[model samples]
Target: MNYRKLALTLAVLALPGVANAHVGLHTDGAMAGVSHPFSGLDHILAMVAVGFWASTLGGRARWIVPAAFVSVMALGGLMGIYGVPLPMVETGIALTVAVLGLLVAFEVKVPTAAAAVIVGICALFHGHAHGSELPEMAHAGGYVAGFMAATIVLHLIGIGLASLRFGKAGLIVGRLAGAAVALAGAVLIAG
Candidate 1:
């Protein structure tokens, strides 16, 4: 992409309208859930990073890692709905973003089970944030479905990107993207 295109894309992404789409909008159900994942940069980055890491692991991990995240996320959401408190939720979320990104950058290949566990722990923080912010009037089931669907889409995107092996250049690009994600997480932590 040319500099102009890159600048435009970044500018569009930085727009408040895109980032804060969920703010002040009162949706009765699934739409609210779907929008929530896209609303926060932290959620988007971490979820995608999970996918990227999974793809790097290859084989069964492609499915297992994401499955673990979604499954555990649901449990975390339930805990949030029931008002179970988890300390430093925001901090945890931000830290996961950084850690996940680094995992992708380094192409770390832990055992599939271990990767699932790590991803599951990260999902809890994300899922709780989603659940705790549920609108009183929204249908809980629909909202959860929507958010999970959106999250799946994000994961697919990351997997698709990671699956591309355009020689060493592609590998370098993937690493660079991971580093950028890590930097974003650090910025989130600072902010």
Candidate 2:
């Protein structure tokens, strides 16, 4: 009845749920490619995290790194659609979560190009999984668009959040998040 109670309730309802599966996973070719990024928690987190990292790192990395992720992810999706099999796609996706999380958690900074490449590799696995799993969606086209739109929004949020404080505070939080992501990855691997 009160504002506090209402906010808490809203938060709980907003959390990830099983029904999320219905939100994405269609493959209307290019349309699906565009949308798939937003459908799942893993993809959303990973994508957004890149944007945050890019913004924090500043300069070209802000755009380059996320762009690398999306581009390579698209390639991976194509591979999946064509049945180009990659070993442990699911595990790879999990690993991506963990590794990227660590990057955020630790605030690890490497060369701009290197960071992009690393994220790109991770994106590939994530994208492939999405592409391969399209059949479950029934009508893949709209699903892709939904997912893609969601994905971009998440990225923007990450960029915005990184700017919330900037400087030392943002740096600390970014590293902490990276560590959290790593932990998440470990959990995924165990599962």
Candidate 3:
């Protein structure tokens, strides 16, 4: 695969997404949805880690893991939108980051089905967070689309990076990044 093209595509896609400079500024649901994933460090780290881990697993996992996450996360989002209570969402999100990060760092191997289940579970917390945060005026459909698109973009980025074969040094760098992500998760848990 052309890593440069993938990287370039990701960079271009990211250019339009502004950070949460003024949270309520986006009156449009699509904008809000797209921007929400980028709003938090926890979300960004966890989502990227999911992609990275999936890539490390390789073969069918690269797609299946992320696909499971998005699917299950949508269910969680619906639950959140309808006022379904989920205990300790914040903690779950943080924990996923640490878990996914560790998975990447250690280059852990598990069956494809198992990886999907793990990422899918983690996605619930993330989806719920997104759903609960929906603005009253924003259309649910648009918001969901936006967030899902943003998420796919993030995953593609992680996949792209992991796909790059930099020999030993590249592998080391990626693993180090996973470690950093894990450390960040730890801090998030503490904070």
Top lDDT: which candidate number?
3
lDDT of 2 by residue, 1-191 (tens): 36346435533433323244545533333345444565566777787787777776788787678778767766776677678989999889888888887777766788899999898898789768876766653444443433344455566667767778567776677677767767777988899
Q: Mark the regions of model 3 whose C-alpha exceeds 4 Å error after superposition.
A: 1-28
Q: Across residues 1-191, which tens digit of lDDT does each residue of candidate 3 receive?
A: 87567657755554443654666766657777888899999999989888888999999899889889988888888888888999999999989899989999999999999999999999999999999999898888777777877887888878877988489999999999999999998998897
lDDT of 1 at 85: 99
- For model 2 the local lDDT of residue 184 reads 71
In Å, residue 152's CA in model 3 sits off its true spot by 0.3
**Model 2: worst 10 consecutive residues (lDDT sum):** 10-19
TM-score to native of every candidate shown = 0.85, 0.73, 0.87
Query: How accurate locally, in lDDT, is each candidate?
Result: 0.84, 0.68, 0.86
Q: Residues 1-191, candidate 1, lDDT per residue (tens digit)? A: 36346435533433323344575664545777777889999999998999889999999898789889988888887777778999889999999999999999999999999999999999999999988988888778877876777777677767778888589999999999999999999998998
RMSD list, candidates in order? 7.5, 8.3, 3.5
Judging by lDDT, tell me the better candidate of 2 and 3.
Answer: 3
**Rank list by lDDT:** 3, 1, 2
Model 2 residue 37 lDDT score: 66
Give the distance in Å from residue 121's predicted Cα in candidate 1 to where it truly belongs. 0.4
Please give the range of 10 consecutive residues that has the lowest summed lDDT in model 1.
10-19
